[model samples]
Target: MPRVSGVVGHVVTFGRVLRQAGLEIGPNRIADGLSGLDQVDLTRQDDVYWTLRANFVTRREELEIFDRAFQAWFLRTPVSPFELSPPTPQSAVLRRIHAAGRPDSAAGTDESPAARGWSYEEILRTKDFGAMTSDEFDRVRALIADIAAERPRRRSRRLRRHHRGRELDLRRTIRESLGAGGDPVHRQYRLRARVPRKLVVLCDVSGSMEAYVRPLLLFVHAVRGSGKGVEAFAFGTRLTRLTRALETSDPDRALQDAARSVADWCGGTRIGASLKTYNDDWGRRALTRGAVVVIASDGWEREESGARLLEDQMARLARQAYTVVWVNPLKGHPAYEPLAAGMRAALPHVDRFLPGHNLASLERLGEVLMGIERRHAA
Candidate 1:
């Protein structure tokens, strides 16, 4: 990548590198690169940025990724005229090719396009968790893990807020940074209290939830893996503690153990009765100190019809949890409406109503969880 050769070839090489890096680039993207450089004037950085923004990026999420990749590839190269010869080595073209014969890994794992809410984000934001398979569900789990593992958006956020924007809480700032010397030479930063919160996941494993149960459990696992405690329960005719089952280090083993323990897996729904049991027994144990309680269910409510009890118990649980989110798989469908008796009853007790039918929708729970974190930290 010397700065003394063919310009077009270098741009082509960079584009190809990105394609190898996991972008869905094709002959068309390659062509766009050639024309893009001509119109944008590679001589100017902003011009080149806009050119790629228009020709290379099609989705909102890709912008962040494509930008970073562009910067790393182009800016890192010497400013002198680059050796623009075509990539000669076949091995170079083959670098980082995923099984799909294309680059699939994010350009920067840190600035993941996924975290920027890419195609998968739309899927989660738009679809249902119940309809999604275990693999798709894992992707959602990964997104949550990504967000949770990330320190903070701005470097300043990790440092003292005063540096970012907050007026120095002069007393604490000076006390923490100042030494015995008259002049302050070293400045120690205070860690800001973020929106720290806990999460509680209550999933329905009745016959009605078979399609969605595994995925939702995986979602819970992702949250828990990110160093957060999550209490999970799968209920049918009766309620069972999935907390211990999910505690195993391995996810697959945890799911299998949980499935084996829940007798009602794919059994009939006993909506009100289950909630009653939860309110009477598990709620306080799991919902301790105000956690975000997320209920994943289809809301069929076929067992003995005690909608009033369902509402009451959910209300009690809601009072203890910082926030209540009701995720209904049916909501994932395009035509789906909240017409189920159980859904209507639980709706009142919920802080947010969402679809949890597929990996796409369930991943959104991360954003919801992040919001709760912000609130708590504030």
Candidate 2:
């Protein structure tokens, strides 16, 4: 917009672009920024970066984008390059030499500079694990797996291996030892302290629930792969049994297999029908005696009949399993309530209704599982 007209036109054009990009900068802020630029000492590249950053950057992520755009658009051939360390005398020498290499009398420069390194925490903090770019999301998922791996395992009954460690069962020992000479031999008895046995996950991959899907899936995969008592499932349009899919050691292969089984990825949620299907077909089969059922959804079922159906299924599941926890993402919100039709209908039957949004929420879930495991162990 400015090239044909002149320097007078460029300032007007820049203001319009910044406003369109969600910045609150108006003619006043632009004037403030323009005036502020003159007072700010920006001899160093980073000093120029900070000068613009202080005037323009209101949010963290914007700093990175604004930095890049500012540098490329304004300071095409900056007098100095950005220094990671301080603007030292040595850096000044290098800057002067670099500047000397370029045309000393360069014109049409805005004197603005780019921001520093990419805004890792800023862009990433808002990113949902499932929707991130492959490499970026993989990093998050790997972190989730690492965190889950580091979590302390729950004390389950299967872990009680020391049968003989209690008061030595003299009566039983003598009875069994009769085959040999009555020698008080050290007979070791071990408990089945294996990983969690049954894991029934009802992930809500609906429109609203997409943000948490990545980390959530990573968490599910971590438990399922641990060779504990785990059977994973994903529910959207219907109930998907992912037990076999998760058995594969490779995360990518496991997820691919799971994706193959899940005909409905992100669609309308039918929690009631899904739970009913699980109850009718696989409930007794999967639960066996008792299993841990974690339902990861926002409790936004579109139908009350479905909610009721889910309630019935949850009731059945509650009886067959060690515990029934409803992991609702909305629960993480400050002003959240269990007022949704799905939540209202199902909350009555859930053993626990917990949040599943951030690292802290996952840690809380781990704690809850520990307590549930202890109760079942006894």
Clashes of each: 25, 14
Candidate 1: regions farther than 4 A off: 1-192, 285-288, 373-378
TM-score (all chains, Cα) for each model: 0.54, 0.57
Q: Candidate 2, 157: how far from true, in Å?
A: 8.7
Model 2 Cα shift for residue 199 (angstroms): 2.4
lDDT of 2 by residue, 72-94 (tens): 55676343333322222233222
Q: Model 2 misses residue 328 by how many Å? A: 1.0
Write one digit per residue (lDDT tens) for candidate 1, span 13-96.
877766655567777876786676666555788887787667777777566667667777778843333222223322211121
lDDT of 1 at 163: 49
lDDT over C-alpha atoms for residue 153 of model 1 = 20
Error of 2 at 37 (Å): 92
Error of 1 at 7 (Å): 88
